[model samples]
Target: MKIGVVTFPGTLDDRDAARAVRLAGGEAVSLWHADTNLHKVDAVVLPGGFSYGDYLRCGAIAAQAPVMESIIKAAKGGLPVLGICNGFQVLVESHLLPGGLIRNEHQHFICRDQKLIVESNTTAWTNQFSLNEEITIPLKNGEGGYIATDETLKRLEGEGLITFRYKEVNPNGSMNDIAGLRNERGNVVGLMPHPEHAVEPGFGPDTKIAMRSGVDGLKFFTSVINSLVNA
Candidate 1:
């Protein structure tokens, strides 16, 4: 399978996301923000970082990029799309996903190994995980809090669209401890954690067995490949 990793002007984790795709047994393709073409990728990932230096609002400018125009159309047609951190903000700004992310309640940037529970495993990006399974991934963001209207929140909960939830603690004051979400079609997912950072055992969050040994995030890539293969 070929997965496309998009790189915005200020994206910092595109390479990491590409590496994760490769490590998960898929070909990684590069997609640029200015390009309308997706290069025929099976799925697409919008990795973390401050796009346009978070001007106006995080991911606000990047949401209007040419690449997103193509991605939004494809995503509606069932192409899988995963957005992380600032990319999550873009997904919301582009209206690809519901709700919005805002500055942390503490008014400071945060970086840490975050624990998340798989709330829904039916999405293309989360099929490899078991429901309610806990995994650790790196999270870094200044504006990561998630908010939504009551009706939207009820709909998400009723439809099982909440893909991941914060475990142990709510790190960013996101409502209902939402850490990630999938669209109604299950082809689009957005989260504030950097799953790309946890794909490599030696470089990811530490585990009880060994230092920096967690590789739970690799499942996100493999799950998408599996979804494509089965499709």
Candidate 2:
């Protein structure tokens, strides 16, 4: 499978995302934000970054990019799309996902290894995870707090669209401690954590077994590959 990792002007983690794809035995295709073509990739990922310098609003400008126009259409047709960190902001801005992200409750940029519980394992990006399983992923963001209307929150919970939730503590004050969410079709997923940063055994978050041994994020890329192969 080929996964396209999009790079906006100020994107910081496109390479990391691409590396994760390659490590998962998939071809990593580089995608530019302005390019309308997706190069026939099987899946697309919007990596973390401060696109357009986060001007106007985080991801607001990038959401209007030509590439997003194509992605939005493709995603609606069931193409799998995963958005991480600032990419999550773009997904919400593009209306590909519900809710909004705002500045952290304490109004400061935060970076840490965040523990998340797998709330749903049915999405294309999360099928490898077990329900209620706990995993740690790197998280760094300024505007990472998630907010949603009451009705939308109810629907998300009732429909099992909530994919991941903060395990022990809410780092960003998101409503209901939602760490991630999936679309109704389960192909589109957006989360604030940087799973790409946790794919390698020696470079990821520290684990009880050994220093920097956690590689739980590798399952995300592998899960998508499996989903495509089995589809």
Compose the digit string of candidate 1's lDDT tens values, residues 160-214: 9999999898888999999999999999999999999998768888866564377
Ten contiguous residues with the weakest lDDT in model 2: 205-214
Residue 2 in model 2: shift from native, Å? Answer: 0.9
Deviation (Å) of 173 in candidate 1:
0.6
TM-score to native of every candidate shown: 0.97, 0.98
User: Mind giving the per-residue lDDT tens digits that candidate 2 earns over 1-231?
Assistant: 989999999999999999999999999999999899999999999999999999999999999999999999999999999999999999999999999999999999999999999999999999999999888999999999999999999999999999999988899999999999999999999999999999988789876666437788999999999999999
In model 1, state the lDDT of residue 59: 95
lDDT of each: 0.93, 0.95
RMSD of 1: 1.3
- As a whole number from 0 to 100, the lDDT of residue 70 in candidate 2 is 97
Question: Judged by lDDT, which candidate is best?
Answer: 2
